[model samples]
Target: MKYDWILFDADETLFHFDAFKGIQLMFSRKGVDFTQADYNQYQEVNKPLWVAYQNGKIDAHELKHSRFLQWAEKLGTTTMELNSAFLNAMADICTLLPGARDLIDSLSERAKLGIITNGFEELQDVRLEKTGLKKFFEQVIISEQVGVAKPDKKIFDYALGKMNYPCKSRVLMVGDTLQSDIVGGINFGIETCWLNRHNAEKEEGLEPTYIVSSLVELKKILIP
Candidate 1:
């Protein structure tokens, strides 16, 4: 099918978080002696804070500082030192997923490419620029910048509005998360492609128009 525009998710879809996790683990193990349980607890606390930030219940600075503070409290570590370590670890590990840059370079020639991510605008922009993927995107709509998150439909619609494209069949949304990318795209009446990198089972109620195991598969399905 011919598509006029394509929206991508930033984290797992383009920027692999697993690499970041590894760096975090390495740093935490060496610096603070964090256990697996501590890391898991940190994620559990951090994710809900992000969700709250997405919903506009909390600001970005608060979310970041608070998550780090809470994690340090649970681990009985120095909050100031741990916070600095977290920032440094994250900064040191910002990298793109495999085939990300090449896929974006190929797709940009065919359709308008952009990113719709639920993340801090500053952080996402820095990561994109660092990974050398920023130039390919016509626009990058971050939830922190837009004050709304995915699956809300408004965020997707806002991205379409920025692209000046009609909300029609010519648009496609590609991402890893079913709750965000697939559900939001379907809600906005656009084709949805689920990037199931791990080959996880699909939920019963949600569906995607296409499923790709890798970004390279996008070229097979989307016509130039």
Candidate 2:
């Protein structure tokens, strides 16, 4: 392997992040019928909050509490309670992406593995534990805990510190998002592989070191 360290983004990269399903499950537990219309409404509020979070316009607590405020008011509960329930529901339904296990298992023997995600700390820990992937990671750096999100060099600096300041050339960042994972790693003077699973059109001035459509493809790129 060309790299001594392989870093991954959690949600939608190594694991499936079906927020709609999670929201539905959370509401169902509260005896509310969460419909597609309801999900659309939730996303209307939730999507921008995530963008704001990644852009450093808001913190994790604000993003979580703000998104569920309307629901909290309707359900006669606190936003904290609703947010916690949503994360719990998401953890319960977590599953690895196709080839994620094989890729991780194979890479574990070669390079150290770590996760640097913008995901909340509560769900990330539980999801990894449930999927039996916790033992494979040398470090799991959550943005919420670090107080800085991706696309910011501070978080990458924090990750490298946790990694004992490995040579930047010998670390590879693999992630599904261009703005955060790809650009962040690039800015930090490391190689990056963009996991373009859906073949999304590439934006100008945002080139990743490599691109692969799936984890299987990624495995070939790294291992072969």
The model with the greatest TM-score is: 2
Each model's C-alpha lDDT?
0.77, 0.95
What residue pairs clash in candidate 1, if any at all? none
lDDT of 2 at 78: 98
Which digits, one per residue and each the tens of the lDDT, describe model 2 over residues 47-131?
9999999999999999999999999999999999999999999999999999999999999999999999999988998899999
- Score candidate 1 by TM-score against the native: 0.83
Off by over 4 Å in 1: 19-30, 51-62, 72-88
For candidate 1, the lDDT comes to 0.77
TM per candidate: 0.83, 0.99
For model 1, how does the per-residue alpha-carbon lDDT over 36-150 read when each residue is reduced to its tens digit?
6767877887789877775568866677677778656766776555655654455457777777777888888887888898865656766776778778899999886776788
Give the winner by lDDT: 2
